[model samples]
Target: MLTWAVRMRRTRQFAWLYATTWRVAIPGMIAFPRKPIGITAHGREVVVPSGLLKLLMKVVLGRATQVFAVSRYTRDVMRDRKVISPQTGVVNWNGLSGDAANWHIRSTSSDDNTQLFTICRLVPRKNVRGAIEAIALLRRQNRLGNCRYIIAGRGEDETALRNLVAQHNLEDVIQLVGYRTDEEVTAYFQSTDVFVHPQIVLKDGADFEGFGLVVAEAMSYGIPVIAGRDGGTADFVQNGQNGILVDGHAIPEIADAIEQLVQSPKRRNQLGSSGRHWVSENLSWSKHAKKILVGLSSA
Candidate 1:
């Protein structure tokens, strides 16, 4: 039997010993209420007794079968938290299946050469404001010309983000395409030159980016990425190799990375190739499925 737990408390509730191997995978951070456990207990805090939790974990690790994790960050957390033994195997999450029409790579460059793309919900944590600010900064420096920023996604912060764009007089440069179907998103990916994911840590002490699937999608089509070093984004984007990883709040750094990719076609091509190679080897669904199968079979 295998179980996944976000907190030590729940680990105690699902206490069962199995002759078969057991696995416990933690997908995100082990932080407290920052990432809450969905279930509550008796109007009080739900928790596992420490002793029982430890015993169950030992049974899974020692006698059961195999253990697996989702990401290096998660694996490290498990080790540090002593939730799982050091011997547990870790597997990164993989890509989704591509739709037929959206599978082919489109030519990223254009005769006019003036379109950028970003696809993310307009939530504050997504840092859409940062992406817009980067565009504004680039324009102020005269580093950007005739380019349009196409942001496609819908969320609570949509109004605020659009207001920011209009406030900056970026009405012509920024376009909010709103929530798109998967096919539409793939079309946007096909049309754009670069993909940017400017994620930042939230005020609640919660950090995200447990592998940005958009980055992988862009790479599959040979588009380079400019993402923040938020959590697991680093697993896909190697600095100055496959793509650029900027400090989350660094507007100038983001602008500079965008400018570099825009100005050099050769560099963009090289980065795109590197990104595709990395995805095939490390981020593909097939690769991840194979790893999971191996762990499950052994368990």
Candidate 2:
């Protein structure tokens, strides 16, 4: 906003705005993209069709002084929607707040049971169903040894996910433990062996995971991540290097990746160690901030 920018200026602080969604980003240059469906207009909430949303994006981001997206895929989407030009837009990857090892302070699951986990809103775009199907498939085939999959988070799909789990008789294999506190999530990460979240983009491209902070958080704990081959997740998860990337829609592939990790602890350790190193080297709050400052100086 004019006052927001002025306030920062009066305080001699950088006035740049950080945006993860288009709705907020557009107003921020004014205040601050998740489709922005059912938004209020003229004091009445209404759904915004794809065409008009595109036009609004063009008009709104056009006025922005500068825009820093969370990932390269995000910047590309903004460019494709004509929201921001190559000159106005840039990608600044997310980073961890502090040291990696400093995060794992909880004692949990000292047993040999490999705990597979994922924490995200229970949404279709998150592909939690796909993960469930994969777990069910693995259980049916007796591929998973003593491992159990834990989905932590609350969402609209909670009921449906629970139904699917029951349908597969995987009640013992997969447990959907709804919404958890930040501390609880960290404790889950401490006990987690491999993090699986092969998320996807909707066909309309209206909904998708912008960036998977949970994936980075898992990596920080030296846990290997299994994410979708598409979306911003690919920006950080390199296949077979630090983490495994799979087709989110393919349940077989997801099962195969999970089975690979379960069967071979060596592979799991390799990926987890490399993932932690990558997070330490590439992802940090300091690095994220510096990228913005350096880019803003040049812009």
Candidate 3:
């Protein structure tokens, strides 16, 4: 019998031997698998770990019965790294539980002022710092009309983000809220004018936003979104259709998208309406489950 160990005390050689012998080893993450498991060309698995740990994962992934990727981008990265052949993997889009449509009603007519919000772990890949810089650019351009950017959630990058806010003297325009509960997040969505998640692939491509749940959540609440053009967020945003997609690396471009939404409440409402409709129709848990099942069956 093959024993799949999610957690174990073992040396790298032993783990490698076990992986080679096992019929199948499904890892929970492509990054270092603490379960004693688990690349892009810049695959996280290739860049994050070192020495024996990295060597072991390379062997496991190269030999696993099938590799599962959360997004098409991930699957491509695996192929690029030669970790898995094109025919041996599948893409499983993440799904949201419950009826996102029934989550909340659209906020009452937005005023001239805009309340921008983002809910994400403050990590480098999430690029919360870039968003804060964009806010600063807005302030300089005199386009920040009673604009308030509220960032909720905490992470390793929180201190750096807070410093960026303070450095810009934007203590009033940007608020770095600590971690928020799910209920608090829902409330933020209900009140927000636009949601922005400026995610970017890391420099090494070791880390990236596989999928942006916040982008969909805001759309579900009938709020337009401005998201990064890179990674899986494009799977939803249609660039001026359902929402706007911007370059996460370009602070000026991000600021422009925000100002465009702030100045045109009519456009925001239109995109938001379309977004809510599209998300309700395409992002149900049932659809995701069916897709996953089909992939699994074929495998």
Candidate 4:
């Protein structure tokens, strides 16, 4: 039955394409493919049809050019699927540009108040609930006072997150400053004490933290991060030295790390400084773009 359904769907797709040849086929055929092109495969796990479509696309599109995967995990997946050969090069994930110098330097001591910031779409896989829970735990123990958490992003889960905040009565402490412009995001990074990314793998085999660009961005601003153990995040965050890596779903561990950073200004400064240095030394977009150009030129 499933086989028949699949065949029927494929037939319908082909029929539609055949019927709309003037509208779809001519334009698709006329477009010239470019080399060193940026192919982003975001959330390739959820949609089987989209994955199949992408696979078919690579069969034709990859013939004359090389491919680059955004994350190491995606690169491995592409390799397993034989989309790109072992000879093809993959670039590690890096963020798009923002105000580079906004948070690169430490401000005066007066601006050092402990504030935790997370910038992500309010989705389940982002583990925003864990961050909120950690804040609640800190507050309950009286370990967190004058500490603020600013979450900047919006999604379908916004209502649920708002409910969780209200249930915990963290309305004042946890502020959901929905969708910020690039400037606003930079401002948050510049002013915040720490950046937290509580990402986690969800059920149905969906994984999160695929080389989180926000974590890297926060690091660029010299903000220490507390990230979950998943995906390619480890490629950037070195636990306990530059940032903290919390074990799976352990709210206590995350809360403890936040509390530790909150109390020790010196440690926070060290971590923040180290993070900035690491980003500068390792993860510049200029370097990645140049490497990509080199690969494409050679290919």
For each candidate in turn, give its C-alpha RMSD to the true structure in angstroms: 8.9, 5.9, 6.5, 8.8
Please list the C-alpha lDDT of all candidates, in the order they appear. 0.65, 0.75, 0.73, 0.69
121-194 per-residue lDDT for model 4 (tens digits): 88888888998998999888888857789999999888988899999999988999899998777677778888
After TM-score superposition, the amount by which residue 163's alpha carbon in candidate 1 deviates from its true location, in angstroms, is 0.8
User: Which of the two, 1 or 2, has more lDDT?
Assistant: 2
Candidate 1 stretches with Cα past 4 Å from truth are: 1-67, 78-89, 96-102, 203-205
Task: Give the alpha carbon lDDT tens digit for every residue of 46-107 in model 3.
Answer: 33655776677667666543455656776676667655666755565566678764568557
lDDT of 2 by residue, 24-73 (tens): 55544542222211111110011123578767755655544456677777
TM-score order of candidates, best first?
A: 2, 3, 4, 1
Cα RMSD for candidate 2? 5.9
* Highest TM-score scorer: 2
TM-score of each: 0.73, 0.84, 0.81, 0.77
TM-score for candidate 3, residues paired by index: 0.81
- In candidate 2, clashing pairs total 10
User: Compared to the true structure, candidate 2 yields what TM-score?
Assistant: 0.84
Backbone clashes in model 4, listed as residue pairs: none
Better of 1 and 3 by TM-score: 3
lDDT at residue 74 of model 4 (Cα atoms)? 57
Candidate 1 lDDT by residue in tens digits, 124-208: 7678888899889998889986677899999999999889998999998889989899888878877878888877755433345
